[model samples]
Target: MSETSWITTPVTADILRGALELERTEHGVLPHRLPAWARAQSPDGQLAMAEAQPSGVRLVFRTRATAVELDTLRTRPAYPGIPPRADGVYDLLVDGRLFGRATGTGGNVLVLDTAAGTAETRPGPVGTVRFGGLPARVKDVEIWLPYNEITELVALRSNAPVESVPPGDRRVWVHHGSSISHGSNAASATTTWPALAASLGGAELVNLGLGGSALLDQFTARTIRGTAADLISLELGINLVNSDVMRLRAFTPAVHGFLDTIREGHPTTPLLVVSPLLCPIHEDTPGPGAADLSTGTLQFRATGDPAERAAGKLTLRVIRAELARIVEQRAADDPNLHHLDGRVLYGDADFAELPLPDGLHPDAATHERIGERFAKLAFGAGGPFAPR
Candidate 1:
């Protein structure tokens, strides 16, 4: 904790990775998951706020320090008439392995009240998260911020000087999906399913999983198209179904267009089209998903009529069937394209083991299951992500 040997370095966006944008603030840098152009297209304040909050973003550098400290300003949620949400967790990784974890004691906390359906920002004292004791050899360190909180990077101090770490030889996997993929209810930033799968598959990650905003927007596709990635995977269908954004008539073409946009930049990149996982609530039923609060807890439920599927209303089952057919038809011309039924990742069997606690989002245990399953199926031998 002594400052005699410590070096106080500015935690600028230069050392940040996995973020699309770093918005400079008077206090410090705010890592944004989405680019500015994408933000400009949407006027919704909620989506705007979520995109700016760092989820997959992390601080990566080479250092010999056994002790490290980072000051941050975090905003958390407080659901009215229900238990408050858990504070964000910070994870520290060294040499590509998890080394330490810490939670902030104080920070600028924002109370997002669900009953009022509004967010209120409250200014608070900045908090310091510190870690001490490590092997003294030079190694890479990553400080992963929480997935569901707005965090501002204030400062980084270490007992020894640090330098930028060179990129690894592994391929980078860029995945796009909805809140589930955005690490909703995930235990920590690095433990999210995508992160776990990346670690297991020996790949770098750039997660574009925007919570509640993965509406197959053209801007997101453009963002992905602009990124340099060795592989690409689109976890489609869930967001489409739940949002009730489009019918089967529009869905097929939308999927094709989205893929077409990505392929414009990465023609031969392995593209895996993932369908929706089994959620009995929306398996056969159409959705305009609704939140149930009769029990004083937030539980999601499908509000759409099941009979509408005959009229092209999309449901999980309907979308899965359509996506499978689309992939099969497209793969004839594009051999690298593939489709995966998300049920294999979290099917009826998984539900029996660990059910979605919120009736929509997966719990922490389910995240682990999905991550491990994805690594085996997506990156294993004969898999699209497998090393050639």
Candidate 2:
């Protein structure tokens, strides 16, 4: 067959899943986890960039194509002091199983020249991600893009015809949390804790794991409420405590409002509240976490004083106790709500075994361990997230 006979399909929102909005770029569509209205309300560049990168977005469709190609412009950010991050990974799943994988190459580069205290952003070459030798029979296919990279999908080409995959009965799990919930130090987009747990639990995942931005905000809860989900999980407290963004008095009310908004939309959805994982630095101390750049390596430091605990300051210990108390009190009226201490998954002993490399995010191994532990604890038999 000639090239003229090939079929090319525009990757539109209809065939996309796990993203709230798809904005058209010069080359392609940029997927945003947060909708337009939400983005407009906040002008924070960090949040905008984080949400624009589709961490949980994937291409869902049905086709008999033996070969497939996706054209995209990926933004690769370079940190001056440290090595350049790895290229984003693309995982292909055929009939709900891992079939093959591909790596995207060459796009835009956002250079953070920390040594010179300068930054630069510029246009980059487009790259093609290709996969071949798929089964000849009609089957379900999922292409999971890298969670960290900002990707603008230009087009999708396949040898065989393709159509949007219809939503099945797979339970949709919408999870909201911190960088830990996001792919922070995870191996890949598909292997994030929530992704791994969803796989083990046999549920479809809609991850809202925004890095450095999982505050118990009204918009986040409103996002969760507006979306359709069977199960909901909120991994809270880390960002709040580390940013030292709130005190005890305000923290309690914020938590309630966040949950109330979500409940307004999904009053009966099984909701799970997870407290912070064990972090020795902030376990006792407070934070307005400062960066330790002395060794030419990026590290975090706790800048908050410990004695402030008496002033109603927030700490991991304080947050956990408050979360447990809040959930216990609410559960009496709402039996579906449950709380889990994140320490059980990554407690003091586990931290001693697998220490955090950044003094913040978990290493890849820990992500897997946490995923497995969560799968068994929450999705296991008689667990709160167990299928009905």
What ranges in model 1 sit over 4 Å off?
A: 1-4, 113-117
Off by over 4 Å in 2: 1-5, 112-119
Candidate 1 worst ten-residue window by lDDT: 107-116
TM-score of 1: 0.95
Q: Judge candidate 2 against the unseen true structure and give its global Cα lDDT, from 0 to 1.
A: 0.87
In candidate 2, what are the lDDT values of residues 1-388, reduced to their tens digit? Answer: 3323557998988789889888988898999898888878777655666777677789999988888899999987777657667778898899989898889988988786644766588778999998888888899999998888889999998888889988888899999988888888787778888888988988888888988888887788888999999999999998898888889999998998998999999999999999999988889888877667687776888999999989988999999999999999999999999999999989989999999888988988999999999999999998999977
Estimate TM-scores for all models.
0.95, 0.95
Per-residue C-alpha lDDT of model 1 across residues 120-213, encoded as one tens digit per residue: 7778878889988867888889999888878888888999998887786989899998788889988999989999999899998898888877
Per-candidate Cα lDDT values, in order, are 0.86, 0.87
Clashes of each: 0, 0
